[model samples]
Target: MLTEINFDGIVGPSHNYAGLSVGNLASTRNFGRTSRPRDAALQGLAKMRLCLDLGLAQGWFMPQDRPNQAWLGRMGTDMSLATAELRYAAMSASSMWAANAATVSPGADTADGLCHLTPANLVTMPHRSHEWTGTLAQLRLAFANSASFAVHEPVPAPFGDEGAANHMRLCSAHGQPGLEVFVYGLQGGSFPARQHRQASAAVARLHRLPAERTILTQQSEEAIAAGAFHNDVVAVANENVLFTHEQAFADREGLYAELREKLPQVVILEVPTSAVSLADAIASYLFNAQLVTRPGGGMALILPGEAKATPSVWNWLQTLLSGNGPIRELHVADLRESMANGGGPACLRLRVVADPATVDPRFLASADRITRVEEVVRKHWPEEIAPDDLARPGLWNAVASARMRLLDALGLAEL
Candidate 1:
């Protein structure tokens, strides 16, 4: 049967606070702090376990080979002779945020009746620009069955694309045809707009989505200034329910009109600034929560622990729970390690609508598979990573070996 599957990226062994992200406030604020790689991976594993416990289908992506000597070689340097900036970029574990991995169109919504995926170029950030190649490789391997899935190359550069982080879909159910929404940003902001309008349009065209069912809206500069770097940082959607901050879109009312007209069952639960300011929302990553449909019937918000502690956010959440809203349950995760680097529950996974049996079994998550991955992490992932550690060859070797061991364990040694 067709269903929603969440493929979370296992936190990498080199996860550290080198402050490579330009507009990410948390990364900047936590710059130079020590990071616990083992704990971070285990925390992600626990979150995956939570999804499994909730009777959701789970899958995973292994960390990419790090101290990416290949990317550095193209830049005319290797790890040994690279500058601090280059080294930091090469060793970054930002891939742990799989939300940027790809934009997906389910078989139900695509013109060809096959699921389609396009990896994001992520050209806006130096640290993330090199991720598409690695991401595409894994995507092709996991969804290799030609009759079931079609994975496409990224939209060419000069037009930035941040993938599924800036995309959303609304439908009566996971298996049905849906209204796809593409959120883009314009120039002239304190922060660079990562998702270009042209890029969003290109992906829609590439996926062959019907024009009438697609909505392309601009993300508000107001939200960007407040550190809402990705649309998912301010808004998230599951089936027909949109859980968002009021200031998330430049023309939220117009967007909602189109959404409602196309799918009238749509329920937009917008939080107002009076109750929770954009600053509070972004700082707490309240909207970054995964608003997912529970296995039986209701909807649940998988939020970071930071949201539960923030007074304003928590207050509004209580109000939401007490009301007759679509979101019926609240689940909080201790993602301190990821939160420090500016990723919440939503950032760690890429969601796809498909038959679980159609996907490669090796990529699917089970308790036994998770236990094996966790064992490898415990054995090899570093205990702590200081900012200065990114420059050390010893750390690079460990990071590379840990990923190789994971790939071997999963029988994906070719990757």
Candidate 2:
């Protein structure tokens, strides 16, 4: 059975590298002139590398558009040249730049995939320029499972807005005979348009199939701007429809209560308050309420700020993967001045696939046990070089580069 899921791991400098920044760069809205360019480049490289690594480590294949690009040479063993090119094109287009340009494409392999496109609609127009590249990539990775794949089109306009899309709130799926949910933002003009009614209608229609349901929330006025409100929240899995009523922008406990009432059999946990941020909230909503499977075969309640607030989130994730289960997590960091402008971790990637058997649970387990990344190198790579060599940024890069060579020696392909 398929048992692993790919997720967007943390994006930031390599703790040892001083020049990398993770996430969307175009949406910072307040980037200064003095931002580090090298760091930005490194960050971008890291993000790209992560995609390639995930594909390799998990045996998952990425769809691409450009096979000639040297970056993808290492991936040839698994990914077809045609698929790689397609993915690259799609990712480049879904980047922050295209989101703002309001340009549309069918999405290429590497140069023109969902990473570069936005749903055509009103609610998403204002934030159209805001890119959620990273989040999309994560969603693609999650959906890359080797079971069933389906794309939900004409996603709700309101929910398709920049913020929601960045959080993967619109189109997301996982597992075989996959579960795909497409969100439509309420449209029809007038600030904070009453699109929920229309959105609800669309959702009902989307879930009309034999094994489908909808999820809705009553969000606060402030949160509503973020499109966090809905009337009835439903999730369909294993031919079961789970429903719940949520108060958007509610406190952690309030959110938990709603989830408990809707899916009482599942265990719910409130994310720590310290991790609360707009990005964290959106991710929590999507993962906890929408996608994650609870301890008891029901939806899990993940309060908005819990994942960021506590390291326990990682610990819990580790526990789940230890047994070959599918799970995903998102973490946000502040990157005000990096290449591409500025944004959180969710805005720099695009989706390409969501297959579980393709993923290796060991990677997730490694991520969970890793308290200090340096330890990863120590435990995984002890002979190539001494740990002190990685202390310097330039030296660290050299070490990283050399480590890549070691990976190649061990049959690890470069991307």
Candidate 3:
């Protein structure tokens, strides 16, 4: 049976409060504040351990090589001449949000019986644009068995991709053939629309997904304008259940009708507009919560602490829990460091549907490994980083040294 394994990105030593993301309110609001990279990495590691303790498969993706000298070289810019923004962009720990790692089509959904992965070319933001190459290399090394996996290079530029954060699969079971939903934003208004129709179509075609099982739906412009930079900010799916806001799509009725017609087993849970306004939805990030099937066969909503703080969302959540539904439980994870930068628990991971035995052992999580990672983070990670600190004289060496310690501890120094 295919298993959904969560590969969480280990927060990097360069994690800082730069407020680089344009549409993310939290990021903007928290700009110039002091960030605790140590706490951030520790919290992320704790979440991974929690998942593992709960009998879920957990893996890890390391941060991209920061203070990226190679990328700086391409622009003919060096530290001596680089501005604070330029340095921060290169050293951005944004790669800790691994949901944007790649678009994955499980073996069950492909024509060749091989799982396919395509690294995203996040051309929408300069800070994110340099991530694809490193992400591809990691995917290749992790899922390199050609007999069972196919990791494709990113789609050409001009066709921007934001990876699985904008895609979801709904199947009867993990091993079964599922329907793939590609959410594309037609317009961003003042903001940048990250996912492109051309890129989504290219990935679908490259994966050899059956035309009848694939669907492309346009994300509502209102959602994008309201800081739903990626579709996950407003909608998400797990198994056959789709949990979304009423304003999440361009044509909600048509999309549901199509899903019903094409995949009769699909179950949709749409939060009404009156219950929670789009603003609250984006602020609370209720849709970005992780919906996972528990060990007892019921599903739980693993929400961030922000959801509990929002009155409207909390009230709605209580009502949702009172009802007889598949989602019967809630688990709150305090990912405040990540949440401050517009990333919740869901944003920190990339899901891969595969058998645990099939994946590389090094990527897999265990109690011993988790403890070791935590120890390394505590020992070497920076306790506080501010925007101005990005340009500090020895900041690059400190970040590099801390990262090396983490890589060595995780046995991922080769990466």
The candidate that wins on TM-score is: 1
lDDT per residue for candidate 3 within 228-338, as digits (tens), equals 988998998988889999999999999999888987998899999899999999888899998887666778888888899999999999999999987998888889999
What is the lDDT of every predicted structure here? 0.93, 0.30, 0.89
Clashing residue pairs in candidate 3 (N, C-alpha, C atoms within 3 angstroms)? none
TM-scores for all candidates: the values are: 0.99, 0.38, 0.98
lDDT of 2 at 242: 29
lDDT of 2 by residue, 1-415 (tens): 3232323322222221111121221322322223332344234334434433344222211111111123334445322333522222222212322111111111211121222222223233322222232334433343344234322333344443332321122112222222222333332123242334354344334324222322333334434444332211111111123222122333435544554554444333323334343343433332323233432343232222333444544454445445433333332332323222333232332222333343433223232233233333343322321223323345334434533543343232322
Best by lDDT: 1
Model 1, span 174-278: residue lDDT tens: 999999999999752678899999999999999999999899999999988778889999999999898889999999999989888999999898999999999
Q: Lowest-scoring 10 consecutive residues by lDDT in candidate 2?
A: 101-110
The candidate, 1 or 3, that scores higher on lDDT is 1
Off by more than 4 A, model 3: none
Q: Whole-model lDDT, candidate 2?
A: 0.30
Model 1 Cα RMSD, Å? 0.8
Cα lDDT over the full model 3: 0.89
